[model samples]
Target chain A: MTRSPFTNPYVLILPGFLLSAFIILWPLFQLGNISLSEVNRFGQIRGFAGFENYLAVFNDPDFYGALWRTLIWTFGIVIGSIGTALPIAIVLHEDFYGRGLARVIIMLPWAVSLTMTAIVWRWALSGESGMLNSALMGLGLIDTNIQWLAQSSTAFPMQILIGILVTVPFTVTIFLGGLSSIPDDLYEAARLEGANPFQLFARITLPLIRPFLNIAIVLNTIYVFNSFPIIWATTQGGPANSTDILVTYLYKLGFRFGKLGEASALSIMMFALLLFFTLIYVVLAMRGEKE
Target chain B: MKRTWLLSVAGAALLSLNATAQADTLRVTVAEYSSKTGPYFEEAATAFEAANPETDVQIEVVPWDVLLQKLTTDISGGANADLSIIGTRWLIDFVDQGIAAPFDSYMSDEFNDRFFPTFLSPSVMDDKTYGLPIAASARAMYYNKDLFEQAGISQVPNTWEDLAAAAEKIAALGDDVYGYGMQGKEIETDVYFYYAFWAYGGNLIDADGTSGLDSEAGYQAAKLYKSMIDGGLTQPGVTSNTREDVQNLFKRGKVGMMITAPFLSSQIATEAPELSYGVAAIPEGPSGARGTYGVTDSMIMFENSEVKETAWKFLDMLFEAEWRSKFTGGEGFLPVNKAVAAEPAFADNADLKAFAAVLPDARFAPVIPGWEEIAAATSDALQTIYLGDGEVEATLDGAAEKIDRILGN
Candidate 1:
């Protein structure tokens, strides 16, 4: 007897299931196991130590500091990116001069390599001999050159600014796609009802782009939370751990300090935090859709 | 078509078999220096291959920042090289993990006595020698003579007080030049701090494995550096500058003096030849003790290597007096071999001679399992002190407590 392709869905999905098991589930299981054990410098498992690594991470002050910093870093980038992108996306959606060229120019930051962006920003922000400093001084904006990446206060803000700069282009592209998907009939009807630009935007554009905004904010939060190269290349989370996020701190624990077990524990915490946020967002979006 | 395909397959198999039979290839990895081609290793490899026709040496150059990570991955994945140059501080960990093979069985008394005692100490763990030192460096104060002359400094600073006075004098020149350049960033921040710490008679760990950072010597060292930053003797953004940045500043004739290793000599020659510079021993502290931070890299053989004898033969060829001299001199590193130091090339170079003078008094950081973490913690503490985030003594005490916990005390 001949069988249809969908007769046994499990059989058809076996390859994908096996691939996910091998690539994702297996490593996650290993990470969970490692988080509960004692791992030495040589990557050797020195027997299991139940809850020891977790307790250590919980009590560590650096971990708490990194948690707080990660929140600030994540929120700052997500909010700043969306805030900047929404306006630009609206403008770009309108018919304007050099709109194609403007889109390309706006997306350039997203196209450049992150490491290259970091290095270029570092050079420009250098205190002693930087183009930014030279231009500022030339314009009589400040009496003395400031070390943007060297000071604790400025370092975190500068990194956040760069994060926002790199994130906005992608956010704008997504918003533009979302804007295009909104039918022009709704906008025309609102305009024909004598709706102002702001009123039309508030009633039509805002409600229509909620899904895109949700995705952009959640994804950008995850991306910025896990970002490493920008902080590592710029300040190394330094000038006294002022800018350290969870991932860079995890890196120090695992690679620099050779504490795999502790690093694994920290990794699980990071994953749990991100997953919790993701689940809440998903649930909220689903509920909204149901309403 | 069937005959042609079979003949081609057979030919490829025969050629591969013949290639394998002709040469026993040994894989060697070395840390990358500033030189793009790694001329020292290339020259040594070529000479060793010439001397041992049956053995082929494949050299892999890795940058220092990622060398340990690469080696760790390779060892875990069972793809470790037959022989590799590793930082001496990592020797004990490698030995403990059973990844490195002891060299005692292969060494003769004459051959064993070739290395300087100080340079050889880090490779010996529990009286079992696991590696041989290939390159060594000692930190010293490098001063730009033109900057000093412009500041009207005739004599090099001799004491911490003298150094501070000289720095103030240089800073007074006032063309945006810093008097002292401190490396507050990664790679060797702890080492730079130790230059002052050791000179002040401080130690990282005592006999009982307790941290000594809270001692008066440590406080004094931290305070001295803090005072330098506060007094404007250092660059404005001292916390952000790495050793490389400070080196660039000095090369640009903007900094008066920086404490760095001898490797900077070659860099200065190539990057800033017109800039005149002088090398001198670091200033003595108030305690009347002088110290220089010594770092060494050694060639280690892996326990899993199949071609052990061929690897040993290649090592022997590379360590011959002539080749060793050329390797050290060409790379601008201090020699591990006694005969290499006597070579005219090193002896004639004034900067090399200056660095050589301080080798006898050089001291290495403690070779322990968690020393890297300790160094990082200490660097953070020093940066905090420099930035005036906390009181020096309290911050150092806090760092010492953290270190003690890391030491499992």
Candidate 2:
């Protein structure tokens, strides 16, 4: 098994390494470089502004508002989506009538794009002709049409609900995989020990699936936070920019307004924020392993 | 030894000759709408190459969003095609970024004088021609003749009051039928609403593109829109609907009338054959103004392009009356060239004729670099007004502030 020190095993992966560097690392480096410079209308780098771009963005009210909105958007989508998904996963895990069809139907949203799903839901929730409003009125539940996506107060909730709808399928699939891996004998023992369904979920299911939940939450958080198409297609974060997430605001700065420097700074800040969340998840998981 | 040296020189010369042959070819990226006009891009390219045997032209068709992204990215990276189709609204931004090349020197005075001034004006900044209009669309009230007949109405309304009455009569048909269709979403659709609003006595900002959102006219416009929604004349999904959905509803015979761009004529004739529609000027407002917003796409050359002459030649060919009439007319694009409207294809088409007739009343969107941001803010304010949760004045005022932020005012 003796090998020459010069015959490096890593050298064999040179092509793959080169490809990764070209595609991933190079873009990251370029993104970093652009964050430090001013890109003009023609996409040429004009001058170096040091961290003035970052400083300007940090002080801008829109950026601050987007930061807040992004937090709320992430928090609402992550917590709400996972909260809805885990229960559905646990329920689908149990044998029931039409369970196969139900699983397929539940996963249907995943088959479609998040943008398409948002569009359909946007239509369904429209003030005048939306199915929800029609049904509500038909049931004598309300006499007036409710502007679900039009008001600042209702728009955020509507966005979060749509995010949850689009995200639930992925979360449920991940959790279902985790649930199936758990031995039935463990649940049976818990049941025999006088644990109820709720107790079984709390004691056995929750503990065993915590790791999966962490993965699901972190992934969903990133996807939901960075999502642009749904927000753009539906609201463009409107009704006074009340629904603007960081990504949409970033998009406005870069594309709509042509503020490349500010947009790049916003992007870097977003990366930092997401990285922070990822580190927290990793730490929690490591702590869970220790426990 | 002398013979060997002579053969080596001959091989190097042959290699240099091959490169010169390849240099004749030009690659371009254009929107799919532009491709639909002729034999796709390939056909037009073939024609261009045939006309100029020395030069070869190639075109790549891209979706609108992809085209915008590609154009921006390419320009930013100091690389771009010689020419491409871009929305007129984006012209200002592109010019500001210095990606667009001014074509004044390449354009003949006669050709420049032939265009509808507004369509040309957006492409002209600081007295320089940055682009040429490839296709243009003007918004107008498209009313369904059959729906009017069903509702016992004979004439399309010429004033706002008459229009309102017609909408009321048509809305009486059933819950599935709407008297009018308007763009109610948060993006470009809102701009359509603004056209009517401005006609009704609203102005976003002054003519100089300042903050006019909070003005009396703007308030009246917001309130008028709210009244339409509140009065039950608008469709069920009006507030959250996109332009496509509104068009679809009209084509499905669900809407009795709508304000839409001229391009919808193809769909009205093909998909909604049962519904006979007529185009009319946007009804006169309280201000006694009859107007519609004009949208156009222009052929812009990038500053970094190495093939400026080739690009200009291609654009000139695109705007040629006969070629454009055949190309844009076949693809259902409204020709931007004023002379092209007189061509047999557009002139003979009844729907296009009605649309073309409204050209005298058409106006362009305000050509400002921050127009998009202001448009978005105004749309949001309008949405809030629709909800009845925000005051028209306050919403407009807030929107004005946001507009100022975008305009750096």
Candidate 3:
């Protein structure tokens, strides 16, 4: 049947398209405009200052260090979360006793607020009174207290560890959903062909869940890239800017330093990088559709 | 025809909503000025409401970091409080933005004459009073009596040499205790150290607001802090110790001395009431200036407020001797007005008296436009020295370059 133009799915999607344009695209455009000019705390706009703000950001070592830390933050969290979550999901998918309780336990981190979790984790990770150090000390594993969040060398990994803890629950939930959707018949047929557990998982389980993994990867990347609370609560990107990520740097630039133009520029750059990674993920996923 | 009727109805509804939303109320936002669950806003609202029966005064209190975020969002969105108690260092940047109202016209001779002019000076930009100083705090030395007594110290250290000697003596107490605590975490800790450096004859910035932290005097102050840590008189964690960490140790009676504000005495009273302690002027640098960090909360009016007159009335009431003493007492802050300082409430306490005595010689942190930036860089450089990883002179030079870069020199 030939659908009327107004009744077509694409045509019906127009309102959503316009709403996204208004809510999302419009502010992005405004941010871009502000990045090229000067707007002080008073909201008064100035003529274009060319690339002075961006230049200033690039010239500062702290900003550069934060940018490097941001890259480490994004990949460390993304890879770490996905890397560990898939195996846990696989194990949990197998029929076993107390699987329901295990699933509930795995998902608990996702139910808590990020800020609340960050605060609790911060206390648990403190150098002096933290639960982790105290336990280690009681175990007689180390003689001295380790300033985990206070040292630059340890602060980044400490942040990543917290990121992974938070990210694991959400990623596991996603993986569980993906695992349930896989057709049981594929596994049965592979078994009929005398396929072992490893072969079944590698050939059948992996390919069928590729789309879900892509979604998980993309969402986790975006979430971790912009994650602020963990770093803010743990060290506030300190022990001397060692744990600073792009979002925190953007915050410091706009608020702490009152350099809104430069901060907006950094925001634009972050957006561009996110967009690039997302596009690559989407393209790869779409190519997989042909396979 | 039907769409037009719907649009007309929506417009009418919005106009009615807007009228009620724009009430004659003064809204104020404060950043983490109150303790958790403290009656900061409610008390101020009650007092402010009582003073002005016709006007409604509301206050919104938030965590300092969140408060800064909210303020930044509001200012960038062209929405802000009519009057807010903002940090003194933040006043200049907001002044440059042109949204801040200068209190020159609002300042009464009596009010202006009360505060240490230098304390209020940070709130001044281009010779205009953009804000009225409300609550002020300064960083001074706090020594633990038990630790001092244990070290066989008969008297609290009054000079740099004496302080160091005391630290060495107390370091003998072993793992659970340390002789002294100096902030080295970064940012504010560095600010604390700079005050010490300047007290010793070192200066972070020259008179023209240029970097001079690499000078010989600056090196001496930096080396002293580094040496104290190296000599085992400070906790190994001092390199990462923030105010809270230091406070924790002091509360546990683990540290002999700490450099902090009058607030430390209150902490001691609340956490370890049995602990004996005393407050003193920060030991003078070789220059003989008693350097310590000075913090002030000032009120600024938004330029676009329709009720600025009413806002000024509330602001004046906020600074009144009686009202200010009550407000500051609740928050553990010092009154900006000299009249309030003379009240028996603050005068009754010996520790409060010592804290107040230094106000005459105390100075605010560098009041440059890029003070926060310089504060972070200098603090980071100081941390490098505190960690015993770098030369004092070279670290200061690096900090100077970073500060100059920030200032666009």
Which candidate leads in DockQ? 1
Tens digits of lDDT, candidate 2, A1-291: 998755777876787899999997897787778889976754568899899889978887777788888888888988998999999998999999999999999999889977788778777877756798899999999997886776557778877778888889999999999999899999888888999988998889999998899889889888887988777777777755777889988887787666777788888888888989889988988897898
Worst 10 residues of 2 chain B by lDDT: B33-42
Candidate 3 lDDT over A61-171, as tens digits, reads 678888888888899999999999999999999999999999999989889999889889778877778898899999999878887776778778877988999999999
Using all chains and alpha carbons, the TM-scores for the candidates as numbered come to 0.94, 0.85, 0.93
lDDT of 2: 0.78
Which ranges of candidate 1 are over 4 A from the true structure? Answer: A1-6, B1-25, B37-57
DockQ of 2: 0.43
TM value for model 3: 0.93
Q: Give the Å error, residue B148, model 1.
A: 2.4
The Cα error of candidate 3 at residue B116, in Å, is: 5.2
Q: Give me the overall lDDT of model 1.
A: 0.87
Query: Chain B TM-score of all predictions, in order?
Result: 0.93, 0.90, 0.91
lDDT per residue (tens digit) for residues B143-259 in model 2 = 888899999999888877787889999999987788888667755756766666667766656776578777776777677667778888878645566787788888877787788
lDDT of 2 at B300: 83
TM-score of chain A of 3: 0.93
Clashing pairs in 1: none
